[model samples]
Target: MHPAPSVIFFTVFSGIGFGLLVFLGLDTFYVTGWTAFVFFAIAYLCAVGGLIASTFHLGHPERAMKAFTQWRSSWLSREGVCAVVALVLMGIYGAGVVFLQVHWAILGHLGALFSLLTVFTTSMIYTQLTTIPRWNSWLTPLMFMSFSLAGGALLSGNVGSATVLILVAALIQIVLWLRGDGALARSGTTLATATGLGHIGDVRAFEPPHTGTNYLLKEFAYVVGRKHSTKLRIISIVLFAVIPVALLVFAPFSHLLAALAVVSHVAGAFATRWLFFAEAEHVVGLYYGKR
Candidate 1:
């Protein structure tokens, strides 16, 4: 819940990258030659760059390779496997489309499926954490997928579809916030429950866990003030949804305007992702009496 910049970038950019791959794999645009090359380049850059960024968040980046072996049990491991499979499939498909000008329909469709699966696995990594009630919801996956698809639409130059999907993503974001606001309380977790002392009596911390901050406090117990959160929510919605939709629907269509919309959307994504981690109420916070 520390809102590490690397993780945020990984989720946002990789989601967008995979989303773009979905559209490309489906042959949404008849891109060929240099145009296809540019599209694939952007997609690969975002996807691969994000994966690389994620390594920096690891305590031992070199050990990241071990994550792939836990695919049967760990969502994180599943994500790694899916990402590799999706990238390889998409790479082959992209090469054919960009250089050979051949649309390998089967390969493209499979790549798209794996790409989507990769995003799902990424979301599950968060959603599976019951310790964080705010993220332990089905809506988390929906939110991720919606944003990815919406961003993909924007990048693919489908202005009409992008407007609608972006609007939907905004609505989902609003709903997620609303639901997450009470998720902690609704989870029935408290100092009593956390310490298994509810049967004894009312439980309260008599003293601090320590005189100074520690790793748990720095990581899982990070907090954001309510007023600041509200302001950021507004900013995120405006940049992610309002401006993009307004420009796409009302402003005269132009490549520059579309690019601006993409930029605004990605910025908004960063804000939303920051809030996602910062606002999470980890059950460990109850141990510190900080939630």
Candidate 2:
């Protein structure tokens, strides 16, 4: 995948927003009045902003609303539906807390369920892509959900829980990278198999598919150097998990320190998300002898 910045921002920020809603729905923060308003405002900003960002990737952004009608057959549609439902439920739940200081336990729980579902659907958008073996794994959804929960916990001020979730998410991140590295090969998808010419003889492209670049090459066949990938992985893990955990455990707890941790984690998330798309080897690239 080309890893457009819009998609990366959408996944990371929207995941965090939904994660925060999960906690709010569960009454984990027990906030009220102006405090509750602030929390909900941040959540909505990230969630809605990320959703809006995704529209830029569409060739016809104006037609995006039609996606919601295909929920039965498209993960993208399901994600849109789930996001709208979650936002509606959360909005109602948030209103009660911000205005009346009342905790509508049922609405909160429902909102949380839908919010988590939205994240799951978002992950499925990539996970369902058989063309990208790296993302077509159970670990994809797990990684997405874990990071969401971890980010939500950090933002929700659940230090103890955030520390544990971050550690778990980090472990998952490492495993996802390891597994993804061999996914294409493990799937038995090679140039020979792709063209169904294995029985005839050993097949190899004698010449380039075309002289110049095309959409496939620019979008699905983008490549990253191994050395650069390694460096970015290390940087992502450090920012995403290590520094935040270290600060939380070793340093005296303070608001300043918490803010730093949040910043570091979000930065790390961005790096990892970038790598997620950049490193993906779409099977379509095999036709171009690129993957």
Candidate 3:
């Protein structure tokens, strides 16, 4: 479970895009049907674009089709399949809105439902990875849901209450991350246990297998100093969560202020996402040379 920036960007960016699409689809049921349809189309396109960009990080991109073979046991496979289903649904819904003049109560609702299911599938991709203790939590899905909604709200030009909710969710995630760190420290385990250790104290990495950093070490084994991590955590909570919420709450009630809040929230979300990846200690890291 190395921190793949490509995958990370894909997840976060596409989460935002799909969330916005869901919100727009939901709005189609209201008086803003045409506007909602336009936004939905744009959001769906962005999500698909992000998905395509994610594949560039894979070494064997040509073999990406093989990912769908393990749907029975692999969450990643399920995610891929679900993403395809959601995209198809959204495309049909968009076409109906554009050409057939379809009502929102029918196709729009179906699209929204599929979008939500897509979010669930996407969250499960990380949540199912038990080797990453930080991600193996109910909060992972909750965080994904909240952040998606937050991004959607911002994109839809409603940054008032949604930003506050996002802040609250981000705070909760930060607390959960702290708890996870404490749990890992108290587990009384070492890198050896992660490789293949049955007894408690019979785990130690006296000598690393390699003298220089390999791909595994450079990826999964990356670590930040405790002091820097703590500082970054505080900054993430403040700049990404608290301050943005404050701006959304009381930012002179001007369009310019709302726009600024949206920008701040997006930037903050990206930073928070990065920390989420950086702070996570994959069990695979133990197999490498990380402690």
Candidate 4:
């Protein structure tokens, strides 16, 4: 799968936004007009911004609305629907907190549920893809969920929550990478199986499919070589997990460092998200000899 910048920005930015909304709904901190303003701004910027960015991936951005009708079977559609529902609920909830300074307990819980569901649906968009074995695991969704919660905890300045969630998310990410390293090798999908040529004899492409690149090669045959993957993975872990968690632990000594932790984590999230797309093995690539 291609790792378009728009999609990466959408996932990391909106993820943090929705995560913040989840914590806000829990009444995890004091709700003041100032706090409400800051939190809502962050949430909407990421959530709505990410949603808008997603359209760029479409050939016809104007027709993206058609996706809304396929919620029954499409994770992408479900993600859009859940996002809209959560945003609307959060909007109303924001109004009460920012204006009246009163908490609508029920609305808050509903908003949080939908917000988390939105993240889950986003993860499912990748997890449902059978061709990408690494992403096909349950750990994919868990990774997304953990990142959201951890980011939310950091943004809220809740050291206790951020510490625990970041550690868990970090650990999960490490395991994801460790396991994902072998996903391609264990896939069992070979040129023979793909073309159902196993019974006849060993199947191998004697020559290139075509002399020139086509849509399949450009879109599905993306290959982030093994050596590059190793370097990116190391960078991702340091920025996404190690640095932020460590900074948060020491943040009590210096609020400045706490702020830096969040900034670094967000930056690291971008790198990791990029790997999420780059590392995926699209089965169509097998036809292109990418596998």
- The collision pairs in model 3 are none
| Predicted structure 1, TM vs. truth | 0.98
* Tens-digit per-residue lDDT, 141-187, candidate 3: 88877777777777776666477668667866776677767645555
lDDT of 2 by residue, 1-291 (tens): 898999999999999999999999999878999999999998999889999999989999998889999988999999999999999999999999999999999999999999999999999999999899999999999999999999999998888989999999999999999999999999889999989998999887667777999998899988955459999999999999999999888989999999999999999999999999999999988888887
TM-score of each: 0.98, 0.98, 0.85, 0.95
Error of 1 at 273 (Å): 0.4
Residue 234 shift from truth in candidate 2, angstroms: 0.8
Residue-level error in angstroms, candidate 1, position 236: 0.3
Model 4, span 92-132: residue lDDT tens = 99899999998998999999999999999999999988888
RMSD of 3: 3.0
Expressed as tens digits, the lDDT of each residue in 1-43 for candidate 1 is: 7999999999999999999999999998899899999999999
With a 3 Å backbone cut-off (N, CA, C), the pairs that clash in candidate 1 are: none
* Model 2 ranges with Cα > 4 A deviation: none
Error of 3 at 32 (Å): 5.6
- Candidate 2 accuracy as lDDT: 0.94
**Lowest lDDT 10-residue stretch of candidate 4:** 246-255
